[model samples]
Target: MPDAGHPAAGAAGGSVPHRPARLPLVLLRSPWFIGLTVVTLACIVAVFTGPLGRPLDVALNLVLAALDLATAANAFSTARHFPSRPVRRLALGVGLIATIYLISDLTEAVGTATGLLASQETLANVTIVGSNLVLLGLLLRYPTGARSRSDRLTFWLDAGSVLVGAGVITWCLMLGPRREGWSLEHLATALGTAVLLAMVAFAVVRLMLSKRPPLARAPTIWAVGSTFVLYASSLVHASPELLLRIGLADDLASSFLMMVALWTHRVQLRLDPDILRRRRRKPFSALPYLAMAAMFVVVVFVVPEGLGMRSISALGGLAVISLLVVLRQLLAFAGNAQLLRRLDRTLVDLRAHQHRLRALLDHAYDITLTVDPRGRMSYLSPAVERTLGVPPAALRGSRWRTPLHPQDARNLMRAVPALLAAAGTTVTWQVRARSTDGTWRWLEVVCTNLLHEPAVCGVVCNARDVTESRDLHDRLRFQAFHDPLTGLANRMLFTERLIAALTEVPEKPVSVLLLDLDGFKEINDVWGHHAGDTVLVTVASRLTAAVRDQDTVARLGGDEFGVLLVGTDRAEAERVTERLERQLEEPMALDPGPAEATVRVVAGASIGIATRDGECFPDPSPPVDAMLKAADAQMYRRKRLRRTGGGRQTGRG
Candidate 1:
């Protein structure tokens, strides 16, 4: 036989070895061949032995031998396929012992009454029993491909029970003739009783301890228990007090044991009735249980008692039980075959789905991830590898909070529970994540809790690196609020500040100073707008530098500027406006001087002060507009005073 690890000579590499075609047919695998051979041999033996008497017993012996031969051959075949050395040895040893027992039994059957009690037969039986014990031990202790701990334990118990039975037979053969009824030397009766009691006790304990709910609660246990109890009760009745003691006791014990065995068989059938039903449904392996049950029913209902029908019925019942067991096994084999096919299809579908999802994720630009309710990452798309430069696998099985920026991590942790509770709500935040290149990248993540969809099952976050966009937005917003020419507050922003100051100073005094450069138009016409703009910008900077930081300086329009003095009294506001005017009046050295124009331009301003009483400025609008108009009127009055040779009034108008 070829070893399990070795390939057949003509087979391709990595392929399993094929069984040799010339080997003897297997009873289980090639049942037709073995069945036919056994039946033909039994028929021949029965024909020669005559119709009645010992012909049936001779045929039974032949059938038993055939079964033993088949078991031995299969054991050898299985031994060659075993990968473990100890298991192989165990199988081979069992096969050898079985072969020996088969030969001895066959020899005894042929020799009939003369050779049945020979020493060779006894030795063969003992060897077979001993080898089976060794095999059972190996099966229990050693791990096999298909056997579990429970299966091993069951095998050990079964083998031990059989050994106990064989020991009883051996004792009976050795000492049955040497003593009277119920004597110690009538060992068969005593040992047989002991074996029956032991078997029932073991069965009860096994049934009670079994993890399988069906077996643990099975009625078979009670049936077997009653059988042994009945037999033991019959032994008590064997005394002279009971009439026709031996005959009645033997009859009752045998009948009760047979009935109990049959009942146990029926209970097993009920426990797994589908097994027989399924077997009948199959085309190749039909229900042997149905046939067996039919035979038992016929014998019980129709057979006459005078023709030794009781013995025939008992034999028929045994056959029925065996057939039922075999049928159930066949159904289990079919179910396993169907399950394997379904598993293969499921695996194939799973692989295909995985491949498609992988492709979609790998090609996407956005970094997508799924997080659990605890804010731990459950899944990350492949795009994370390309976008964040971090492999998806690397981020898997890690908490999302760990990857967040330190400043944001605490807030994110707190938000997780709330987000989970809200279900469909989306939360957005900016976080920093470590990239594959070991640099931190700013990620704007929008996470939506998909609690609405059972399939979604997690928080889905779609993140993108928005650093460039954020920077651009900040720059654009700054430009919108500030003057591009001078980089100072623009008209739009100055108006907003004016409104804010008026609203803020409900009881406090506030002032607005409006300044316009004197003779600025002539300077611009001669020196060009570019030179004029440079001068205006210079003046605005000086004004900004002179004022307190809280004060506002803005280029209101062409050649006009405004300042809103916060928290200032009328005196302080006058002093600040004077200081700004003086700074602007300072001579600017214009570039490209032929120095012919040689001009020193004086810049002056009009000041307006607004102090809030309880009712003077009741609304925000009037106060802000009035402040600017007052400042403008004061500036005109001052310019007229300067032209008329009147001294300039610095007081608030």
Candidate 2:
């Protein structure tokens, strides 16, 4: 939308989304228009009546003053409601100009009605000149779209040509012809009228030639029409052949046009300034050419009267006009050359930047995608195929979250609305994505909001694959708590489970069984360390098979192993011990190597059982160290009994 400070639509940050509303039709039926029309008809009737008597003339002047005063009041009141700064300033300037016109009309009326104000003609002319000067100032001070220094310079050159040519025409028409017995006052009046006409011409020309006009086309056209009428009226009033009453009628019509211009502007202010279309300007204005043609016509008419000082002056003015035109063309050519050079450099830099961006997007390990406000993928980089095993073209226009795990997709969809609500916010999240190979891969995605940016207008996502790292982390966690060789729980894991069972439910029956191979060391000495490893592997397998799936079996150290039985008492523990004993006793077949025959050997294990019982255990009732010590004592007692000829298969708890 156009900014309040600038009036030109589509200028820099001035793009609009809708067409500007037209002027209100009710203005045609407005009281100001009706009154002005009635006054115009009366002025025409009075002009055709041959003699405007003093009483009637004073009445008309007073009526015109009143009309001007009303216009000024309306302008001032409407200006207060305008939202645009430039529009408001223009409305206020119009009010001030109308107020000056009112003062001029009042001065003329007072002079006609009363003879006390002797210098009324001079005062009236001064006020009228002051008002034109104010209009000139307002036209020049109005803002235009931003332009280059060269463009502004060219505009001024063209303006200077028109102004210089108008000066020649003003001199030829108002002051060139000889006048016999002319008074100083008469000469002064003619000169003032000529200067005022030139000012009006310049104001109109400047408004038309503006690259970005402060007013819309309709209002500006009406304003230009008003000034042109004033210029024509001043010329007719200065001429000796035209009736003075006709000039007055033209003045009345010019005032009417100005009022219409103000009313149109008021209607414009009621609509959104952002939707108003500014007038487009031509590449080159023909106004200077028209001014030169007028000057030449004036010179042709004045030259045939004889070769005099005015003739020479008119020819010299034509030469100056020619020089200005040539200089303006040269400046335009130079400015074009400079613009072309700058454009070429900008194109070269843009191409180089694009090449570098393409290289980065193609080679980067991370996949980059742009998602529009509709949640569809607008762009995906070349790395998408390499990282996700999915082609970029297939995903374009599809939702980027389609391949994500169900929970992750839901979470991303929920967060997308918040991320889009604020511009430039960024979020990073990890999601599991199903690849073409039917394996779920981890992707760490960083999404940044750029919906406010005109060039981007989408959210940018950079995703990097992290599946290998995640798998390595899981393996490391498993190795921290389990034995690497036997794939069974280690001593640390067994102790942790025992402590958890004791603290979770204190009244629940829990027991630990400790076991030691009877002659495992002798087997390693006889068949090398390879045979000892084989025996340990076989014994671990049998122990795991003998217990329930919920029970935990661990390699304590060396040839010793441990088992934790939950919800079990002494009798249950003894039954498990007998099953473990039978499995270990039957596993005896072994092969030393391919070169040796198979040998049968019995690898028996001594077992001990300790149940958690507050009545049997000493001071530290259910502590982990106290329970482990009780089981160790029972295992040693059983080993001693077997060695001293007391045959015992299981130890008492």
Candidate 3:
């Protein structure tokens, strides 16, 4: 950052020495400035020494005309270079008003030297009023504080008073010019000048009372120079008409200083303008005031003006005006301080509320968060460490999305916008959130848009771990459709499967195979139900191993099993039945109990096969019971054939 006085500080803070503008350097560097200085010097010399001849006076008039053009160029430069918006605008406004003064001066000068016009009094009057108003505007725009809504009415009212005072004084001065008491024109001009100086004093005092950067101090110092020249030109003079020439020099000097101030500030800041840093407070400097006063005293002696009663009264009036200006500034600053304190307190309270609200949100669920309108994460509650295994600090500004499970992230991205656009509605969904340990857990999230609320101007989302609950639900659903003992489809499930296969077949042929364990009831009566259960489990495993993966095996009842095969013809069904019989008749090892030794068990299947195709399959689809009844009758007939025949006879047909 550049120094405080520089625009790089933003006219805000810090301290830097105020550098005096080198007017001589300006005179040397710019031909325009040098030319204006020479013309002004000639005019000043003419004011003191014009007794040599009329030619000298005519020469002085020409110089005055040249000064008009020079001053305009000066105003243009000042307007362009002025740093802040208010100052730039004020300078431009002053430049506009100064143009009127420039015109009037040039007219009178040209009229005197070349005899171009009859009278220039009207132009002169306009100059006097217009220039003073412009000066008044500059003072008002000086940095003090911005207007607040509460003070706006009062500010306008005060401005109205200034207008009224100017009007009354101008009217009185105009009347006096016609009557011959005090010249109305001179008094009006003096009144305008006085009010303008008072405004400058107001700005100066306010600036002095506060902590100001050196840039700020430069203006105040220039204002003092202006006040000095304005007062000295008028106070020492007998006629206000005679004071115009000297006053013109002062006004020109004022504009010159303003232009220089702008240039110096810009140069100090360099490429990085420091306009935003705040100004710091410092003790008031009495040296500049003392130096100016000393300078003023010397000018008084040189001009040889005695301190008369009128002079005393004038001095007293100027002091009173300055005092009133100071009083008004003090009140304004006092009000500004009070308002600043209130604003600070409000900010503190807001911070406190934010802290408390966050604490509550952290403990509300496994993880809570807020997402901005653009889907950026604005807040992440502390419980994220427990739920998502993410640290609280790690998930700022949409970073939470980075660790989401791939499929879940896609789901959230698609769902978030639709949820926010729901407007006052809440959406709940389950997604898999990846943890820090690289495991994915299922989370059920409830999300709501609270964008309209001041406290939460984003979407509030609360998520809880639901992986355990989901797993439990799946297990319960599986158990409802599967047999507990053999881990196959139960009788209830087998009936449903048979019905579905019948409806689909002929399009894809269907076959059902049912079998009973031969002599299995004798083993159960001898060994116990536990040994029988072990044999059944062995039979189920073998049966599953024998068939195609697409086939469904079910324990239909005690020692009875069924297989519903879809997309199979009669040949395929016969081959599968032969495989199942072989696997079941093989030996099986059984554990009766912890107290008992292991038992060897064997079981053979008495098989029955039923088939359906386009011809045999009923058009409306045969009932599940009809299919089961056919299989059961065939199983009984096979059982009788096996008993009649010898040596584990195969009765599968």
Candidate 4:
């Protein structure tokens, strides 16, 4: 549904505007057109100055009144065609006044034609006075776009202040002057005229003081001009000579102004429906000051001529004006002080909020960073010093990748574009970064893209030092796959590596060696299990040192040990077996106590070797269990030969 108060909305709701001819609107707006119209009206008024009889004069007056009525009716009818309720109501008031004027003019014209001028003149005067009062009431009640109580109050205050100053001047110039031997009728006429003048003053003030007037500025200006001309015409009627010469001329000029106002109103309405709804508030008005200055001028001019009752009265009014000015200034000062106080409170609240936010960011365990789209750090939180061992200022405006390890930096570069592509998303990654001490530390970083947010127009990164946790995890994993006593690969990891070397690349040569410690039970009985453990530890170290770095060395339970050598053929396996024998031949030291001397013992082992090459497994890879069984059988066979004195003797097996 369209808004009923706005003409544009009504037009959208299917109301067709009555478009008037543009010729009249153009002519009315032109200065030359107005001057020509005034000249024509003056000529018409000059016709009344001729020695024309009463009937012809009455006929001319009737024609002029009819013309005025037609223009007023045209304006009212056009306003009715529009949807604006305010314009229609305003037009109704103008139409009522125009109708009363036409009726007053008709009464005098008809009475003159019928030779009943005395009674009709009184009726006309009464009607004019009533119309003036009605006009003043309308000026007070009519809406002038003041929508709030404060706005309306301010409008009236400014208007009242200006009116007071103008009233003082009007009294001094016109009303204060006393004429000799005035009759009762003359006195009554003077009082009525004074009242009418005050009414005109108020209308002019209201028109000028309203910041957002109900009508368009140009139309309202034309309307105010018409009011001034009508008021002047009413005053001229007091002089018989002026009345005979230019009385009708005043009416014609006023009608011209009214006609222009109506035409301008129509033109504006056709152009834009809500053109009159201009809202602007000025903080200051010079009207009161201007009024005060005028009052001072009046006092200066009036006091120089001698202090009479009028002078005394003017002085009193001046004092009242000065007090009003002071009171208004005080109110303005109070408003300004209240505004300043409110601004200070708002600023304090903002500062407190900022303080709390900074405190949280500083105390957090995470090192938060604000990074721009170009990957430069805009802000690094104070927590960075505690976590990264570097102050925040050292990293700000630098690239986020600056502290990252080269390999991690490359990985992060690959991931960052994908992260930024999904704007406003959060992603977590663990990367290595170099701390201030030049050691790489693991960091768990969470990044969120917030470039679209006004307050945080960047990517937010929350990085935590996770190096301790990472080290603990690595230790746990190592314990799971390694021997706790010797820090060597356990049976599980040895089997896994052997299987991988055989199955992953079946064509590669691989070798496995199994050795059982000789006379290990005798040593445990002679030196106790403590010395036995030391012997096992020394043997494990020697075996690991003898094998290639890539070979797997593991304790295969009890006093047995195993080695896995990848990419080794039978010849290389035999040479590695010889090296292991030589390493075991080196003595193992067993210290009993501080009180006892250190004893030397030799730890020897019966060794077995199994090799897999293209010749051993021509097509399919050898099974892991098969390789272990082969190595074990060979080791047992060598032990039996050593016991039977059939194997080569290096040391006691």
Please tell me which model should have the higher lDDT, number 1 or number 4: 4
Q: On a 0 to 100 scale, what is the lDDT of residue 201 in model 1?
A: 41
- Candidate 2, 432: how far from true, in Å? 3.2
Off by over 4 Å in 3: 1-335, 361-365, 370-379, 388-426, 434-440, 448-460, 491-519, 556-566, 592-599, 606-613, 618-653
Give TM-scores for every candidate, taking all chains together and pairing residue i with residue i.
0.46, 0.61, 0.47, 0.49
Which residue pairs in model 4 clash with each other? none
- By TM-score, the better pick of 1 and 4 is 4
| Per-residue lDDT of model 2, residues 1-653, tens digit only | 01122111112233456765445655655776677768767876776575756776677777778768766976897779766687578778889989888887887788888856676558766876778778778776766543878767777777777777776666556554663434577557666765666666666677667765656677777777877676564444344434566666666767777777767766776665543454478788887677778778878888886666557667877888888888887887887898899999999999999999999999999999997766678899988898778899989988767778999987876666556555677888889998899989999899887766779877789999999998888788778777776777889999999999888888778889999988898998998788888788888898998899999999988889999998887888889988888898895767898999997677888888888755445333377987898788888888888788786756555
lDDT per residue for candidate 1 within 229-254, as digits (tens), equals 43443244234434233332332333
Winning model by lDDT: 2
lDDT of 1: 0.57
Cα lDDT computed for each candidate against the true fold: 0.57, 0.76, 0.62, 0.73
Ranking by TM-score: 2, 4, 3, 1
Could you tell me the lDDT of residue 28 within candidate 3? 67
Displacement of residue 115 (Cα, Å) in model 1 is 76
Which residue window of length 10 is worst by lDDT in model 4?
A: 1-10
